[model samples]
Target: MYSRALRPCLITFQVHGRHFSSTKQNNRRVTVIGAAGGIGQPLSLLLKQSDAITNLNLYDIVKHTPGVACDISHMNFPAKVTGFTGPDQLKDALRDAEVVIIPAGVPRKPGMTRDDLFNTNASVVRDVALAAAEVCPKALVGIITNPVNSCVPIYCEVMKKAGKLDPNRIFGISTLDLVRASAFIGQAKGLNPKTVNCPVVGGHSGVTIVPLISQCQPAVSFPQPELEKLTKRIQEAGTEVVQAKAGAGSATLSMAFAGARFAFALIRALNGESNVIECAYVMSDVQGTKYFASPLLIGRNGIEKNLGLGKLSDYEQQLVKAAIPELKANVATGEKFVK
Candidate 1:
């Protein structure tokens, strides 16, 4: 996992039920599993800064979870931090959570495909999902675990078995894909990355990730060759980071930032903000795929509406067609995990 301790140089007001944001009045409980890992630690730190989180639970199989919680508790945020370790504490961690973000699982190593992580991560997600189903079935579950194409279905199937499946309440954190797509596209077009919005659809794996650069928010133009190349870059960006790490680990920092972005957006929506939107991989009939990533309007009850893939150019359409078979295989692989 991607856990290097970046300096905590954040600024805010004095603590004890006080925060800098005027809109920080929501008293929602947020739980993070895998709080000791690379992505988990930074993600926990980032979540600690959120005004929407009144209670933040950090749970991990690792014994150091409490230590991580203790570290984050000293921050100048209103959210009270608590740590829960191992299966014994999982129920407590999830007891009343309104949002659960699972980043638990092994990270990809050099030369390892996301599918190579299937067996290990599938079980991790299954256990977590079952726990969520048991204790907080209505929590907005955003999955940050890998092999997401497979893991999300595994989580959903477990919920389904428990008779607690709410397709709208479960989501795969495909925010990283959209984040990368927007940044890369913005860089290509000399636009502000923060202002760029690119809808990345399809699943969360290699070939399954489809970045619709043609539908970018600013309505920019790209030549066919450039578009094709940029799309490929976005699809393979995860692997690109993994390889660049040279066996250290996968893309933890960027993934944490993207995960936090998605979590905050969901929290805002849950807190009654209107028009909150983000791209997520979720169960969908969109494009006939059992699960697909698309832009979703998040509301009080999770996904208000799935804004299906808008308009794909001929090349984008070709990408979707090419991805279907592989995506179906991934879905089957996940659905088979419990059965």
Candidate 2:
């Protein structure tokens, strides 16, 4: 169904067998905290196709939870599907999972910024994230909740209070920005997005999203004005999707693709894959902030190495400078939520 309607741009990178990969396809349970909405539904569907997952549980307050569960269960993938419709059953949905991807909370709509979503989704994601903290304390959490710059700090603080927060294991899924930047750049320059890598840092919200196009590998130089246009385009890609959708929702299908891509990277790292790197907003001291995004090397234990900000072009440096205040403000928002 997804293939017929939603084009899958990501090509899976897998090294067959459990000895080299983290995918057990037997006992490892993975859970989705909010699996009913636009992002969640597509993300869950992507997870349904993962071989590393043996059990897939979904938690959502929506009434259609069981129907979504039933629908996903029909997939030929080996994972078993279960749905928890409310907070009462949230524990059941989260129990003993090795990985949890939270795409819960409201998406950005017309006239609202991702930060504007903080008022509504902050508590929703925090509450659901706390359940994962309690039920699967050690699970690697890939947070897809918006205001991610802030919500991640919220997740960190709440998990800390619950005595389950692992700095390395909790990641704010910022792969979408990188995905979007690469796609946009690729389209304009006619390069394959899969091979064009751009390092996007700072935060996941507007103005806070900093794409280091200067540091792109297999590099190409953009004329100064063209560079500014490309950077602005990458930064505003979320709003581009929103305005194009005309109040329907934010980037769902593309985000779903990015979510799947990040999830697969996590699975590979856990399996001891070497040279695995993905960008995510997470706790870091690389830029004087408690959390920042840069390239991170993943291994059997989540983040094995934090690759600090590499050399940037003068224009890129200014972009980062401009983004810091916005990113810092966003981080402070989530931190306050937890505090």
Q: Candidate 1: misplaced stretches above 4 Å?
A: 1-24
Give the per-residue lDDT digits (tens) of candidate 2, residues 1-339: 111111222344332422322445345677887799898898888777777777889888998998999999997767899988987988888888888888888888888888788988899877876777777787888999888888899989998898888899999999999888878888878898776777788888777788887767547788888988888888888899899999898899888878878877777666665677888899999888789998888776788888777777787778778888887888888888877
Per-candidate TM-scores read 0.93, 0.92
In lDDT terms, how accurate is model 1?
0.85
Worst 10 residues of 2 by lDDT: 1-10
Q: What is the lDDT of residue 329 in candidate 2?
A: 82
Collision pairs in model 2 = 21-271, 22-271
TM-score of 1: 0.93
How do the residues 38-125 of candidate 1 rate in per-residue lDDT, one tens digit apiece?
Answer: 8999999888987778999999999989999999999987799999999989989999899999999999999999999989999999
